[model samples]
Target: MGFIETFGIVFILEAADAMIKAADVELVGYENVASGYISVLVRGDVSACMAAVEAGVRAVENMGAKVYSSIVIPSPHPDLLKITQIYNIDNLLP
Candidate 1:
């Protein structure tokens, strides 16, 4: 779990991961919650996690994926935590 923004700043997902990796971020885990939907789980500060999501979104968009909506999320969401815990994932890079 992490915090990305206190007020509101979005990075798109792909961009956030790229930027975080470039910054040498070592995430504890990353997981996808839904099928055919671009969502993931990672461990870091809320702000950094938010950036990762944005970075992912950017990468998808760069590959020509259409973005319909975007939103900032809270780190403690039960669904997200559940997915991360069940997967036993850790240290996401790229």
Candidate 2:
């Protein structure tokens, strides 16, 4: 699993696109935390997730977006998934 949080709609969209294209990851969920903060979640194999996260960060940085944070979890606990509502299902990109 992977997560990328950044500012600006354009940055988020471009970063998500780069992430999805860079690996076999699937979008799981997204959150708009207000005040121009946005978070995206993706799920896939460990390697793919890592690659996607790297791509997301690079894409956002290249676009001059204020990247807040990012993460890649090889095997997240099922309980954590439940709490975050980040299911294995693919979500449409916004």
Candidate 3:
């Protein structure tokens, strides 16, 4: 799992675009924490998640947007998903 935090929805969308295009990853979702702060999430293999996050940061920087935080979790705990519902598994069910 990877997370990229930045200001504004536009910046977050740009980051998400760069992330998905830079590697084979699935965009879990985003969280708007109010006051223009947003966090984008992605899930994939460790290397891919790293690359995606790097690309996302670069994209935001290139747009003159500050990246509040970024991280790549190689192996996140299953319980974390249950709590956050990052994967939105319920939406994927048939």
Q: Judging by lDDT against the true structure, name the best candidate.
A: 3
lDDT tens readout by residue for model 1, 2-91: 322111122235544564674333445333324433333345555765665566556656756554444544535555644455656543
Better of 1 and 2 by lDDT: 2
Per-residue CA lDDT of model 3 for 21-91, tens digit only, reads: 99998888899978999999888889999999999999999999899999998877766756567546543
Residue 6 C-alpha lDDT in model 2? 92
Candidates, ranked, TM-score? 3, 2, 1
* Residue ranges of candidate 3 with Cα displaced over 4 Å: 90-94
Scored against the true structure, residue 3 in model 1 reaches a CA lDDT of 23
lDDT of 2 by residue, 28-52 (tens): 7678879989888888888998999
- Give all candidates' CA lDDT scores: 0.46, 0.81, 0.88
Q: What is the TM-score of each candidate against the true structure?
A: 0.47, 0.85, 0.90
Ranked by lDDT, top first? 3, 2, 1
lDDT of 3: 0.88
- For candidate 2, the clash count comes to 0
Off by over 4 Å in 1: 1-38, 67-72, 75-83, 89-94
Clashes of 3: 0
Better of 2 and 3 by TM-score: 3
Pick by TM-score: which candidate is best? 3
